[model samples]
Target: MTLEELFAPFGLKAPPLRVLGLTLDSRRVEPGYVFVAVPGVPLPHRKPLDGHDFIPEALAKGAIAVVGERELSLPVPYLRVGDARGALAHLARHFFGEPDRKLALLGITGSKGKSTTASLLHHLLQAGEKPAALLSTVGLRLGKEARPNIGHFTTPEAPEVYGFLREAVERGLEAAVLEVSSHALALKRVEGLSYRIGVFVSFYPDDHLDLHGTAEAYFATKALLVERSHLAVLNTRLPHLKRLLPRPHLLFGPGGEVWGEGLREGEEGLRFTLHTPWGSGEAFLPMLGRYNLDNALAASAAALAYGLSLEKVLQGLATFRGVPGRMEVVQKKPFRVVIDFAHTGKSLEEALKTLRATTRGRLLLVVGAAGERDPRRREDIGRVAARLADKTFFTEEDHRTEDLQAILEALAKAAGEEGGLYEIIPDRKEAIFRALSEAREGDTVLLAGKGHERTLERGTLALPWDEKAVALEGLTALGLGGGEHP
Candidate 1:
């Protein structure tokens, strides 16, 4: 498609201009392609060599044209847009042949549970015989085939997001479940894509404080997804959920559209009595926490909204084993070992509380704060571990450029009450082993962060690592628990 044809729908009046492909990254720009200069978060409107300096580099790199906000003194055809990111999303839709036009799309966005909910919805729909695909932090999954999404951006680059959807459509996926993020929504990554249903699992005011500046802005950005959808599945029980989405929506509660009551947590998983509008059933999810119940309910609403049979929905929900890293139980030796991706304060508290509810013995939690994220939540995460966990071990979680020990110290300070139960372990492998070695038969060890991530990144190295594998190895070495794995 030509550049003129791509932006024609967005009211860009231009003479015919040849275009082969589209990309925002200069390194990936090729001949006959338009290079979109996105105003990055850190250096807005500034090119690499210097502000206004890298236009020559981009031009020299075979970029036929450039699309950016600032006026460039380039000889090639350059188009300016009010917001480059928004324009990119719109152009991506056009470039990808508007794949959503032929498929059903569902978007789930929140501070937490987005991954689990999207996965759950995809699994449920697939079990009901609907062709489904899932896009989330975990990766893109089309049926049983999973692919690593190296796109660091949660929403991914707009072009890449649309490209994934195009692939899904080409693969004959009937339904697509996208895990939307606040940054993605704010940047209009999901723009031009129609969603049949939207699910708001729950929201917390941590992570991405740098992007949104304030909680209200963060929430308002996320609400854009719900507003754009045909129907919204919401947890009316949450104050933030109600406040952000004030419109009349499908409520999931006790006896609501999809409700969970009589929730009991145990070593096996969470046993919750589900009461839906269709009928009542009990689900034994191999996941912990009341928050996860909300995830299941949100997923159930998505399934029902897709017009599945009641029996299918219940069966799907009942048979769902668990999502990797979202409160996944790894070792059940003398004690229980859980590996979860609970990095946020709210998630940490919820995981601990769920463990407390079901654990017959003590709770030993190993947690860490991610480097270069919302630093404010670091201390709060520690405090949550301190308050709820019997033993808390703080370590480094993807430090990036930040000091690992500094991160641990901040976590330690926030763990005001957990001083005695806390220890700083810089090495993650040792941290896991130490936790396992200390755990007794009845105790539960919770390994937080890096749940399903197959790689553990330390500095410039990304070594192969899996939490469940490490936990099992530790358990085997300790001669404790045994269970089945796929």
Candidate 2:
């Protein structure tokens, strides 16, 4: 398409320069590409380069057109827009032939359970013989092929989103499930796309305070998805979210359209009777925790909203094992070791509470807070650990450019004098070893933070790290080969 045609969506006139693709990164610019120069926000660990500074580099890379907040005096066609990020979304949508319109898009956004809900919905659609794709905190799946999300972003950049959607359409996929984050909405990363069904799992006042400035602002950003969605699926338990409910919306929770009764938690999984508008049926999910039952209900509600049968939803839920690093049980022997991505205070509390109930003996917890992120929850997490666990080990978790000792000390202080059972270990592997080495028969160790992640961020480097792998190594070093407890 010509540069003029591409900028026409933004109501800007451009020279008749042909373009092959669009990009924000100068390094990705190819011959005949249209580059969008969006300003970057300064982060705690690293400062982003101003896209305006890369104009010359992008031009040298054979970019035929440039989109920016301000016009530039360049030989190539230059188009100025009020918001370059929003313009990028529009241009990408136009370039990709609006793939979102061609595919059924379901967006699940909240402070928690997005990954689980998206994965379950995708599994339901696929099991029903309906073609579907998924994008979540865990990974990206296209049909039968899936890969880990090494990028570590819940919602990818707009270009990648459109690119993936285009590929899904090319492959004849009928639906796409995405886990949308609050940061993505705040940054306008998902500007031009609309969702067929948007689900709100749950909310809490944690994380991303440095960016959003206040809890209200953070929630306002999340509400954007509900505003733009054709059908909104909300958790009625969260009273604040009820204002977002529109006509044709489905509420799920206690006293909602999709509710759970006779909830029973067992060591293996959860067995609950689901009460839905379609009918009431018994459902058993092969996963731990009550929060997971809520996740299952959210996914089932979304599938039903998308026109799937209740039987298919139950079948999919039954066959579905679980998402990795989400209360993932790595061992069930002399002592059970579970790996989970419960970094927030509320999530950590839920995890510890669930384990405390089922654990046969003492419950030990390994926990840490990420550096350069929200520090407000560190104390809350420590407090939760102090109240619930028999022993707590505070260790390193993504201490990017921050002193690991300081982070550990803050948590230690939060545990206070009353909680004397906790110890601070700067090295994560040693902390895991200490926790496992001290464990006896019938004890359970909960490893929080860094679930499916394969790297540990220290300073500016992401060293290779995996919690389950490290735990296995610790077990081997201690001469305790893999075995289950009687």
> What value does the lDDT take at residue 31 in candidate 1?
80
Cα deviation of 342, candidate 2, in Å? 0.5
Which parts of model 1 are misplaced by more than 4 Å? 7-20, 30-33, 42-57, 240-248, 360-362, 416-418, 454-465, 472-486
| Candidate 2 lDDT trough over 10 residues, lowest sum | 477-486
Top lDDT hit: 2
Residues 427-476 of candidate 1 have per-residue lDDT tens digits of: 98899889989987689899997887877766756677778887888777
Question: Which residue pairs show collisions in model 1?
Answer: 333-480, 333-481, 334-441
Q: For all candidates, what are the clash counts? A: 3, 2
TM-score, per-candidate, Cα-based: 0.88, 0.92
Tens digit of lDDT per residue, candidate 2, span 116-184?
A: 999999999999888899988888899878977736678887888888899999989999998999988
Query: What C-alpha RMSD separates each model from the true structure?
Result: 3.5, 2.6
lDDT of 1 at 198: 87
* TM-score for candidate 2, residues paired by index: 0.92
**lDDT (Cα, 0-100) at 18 in candidate 2:** 78
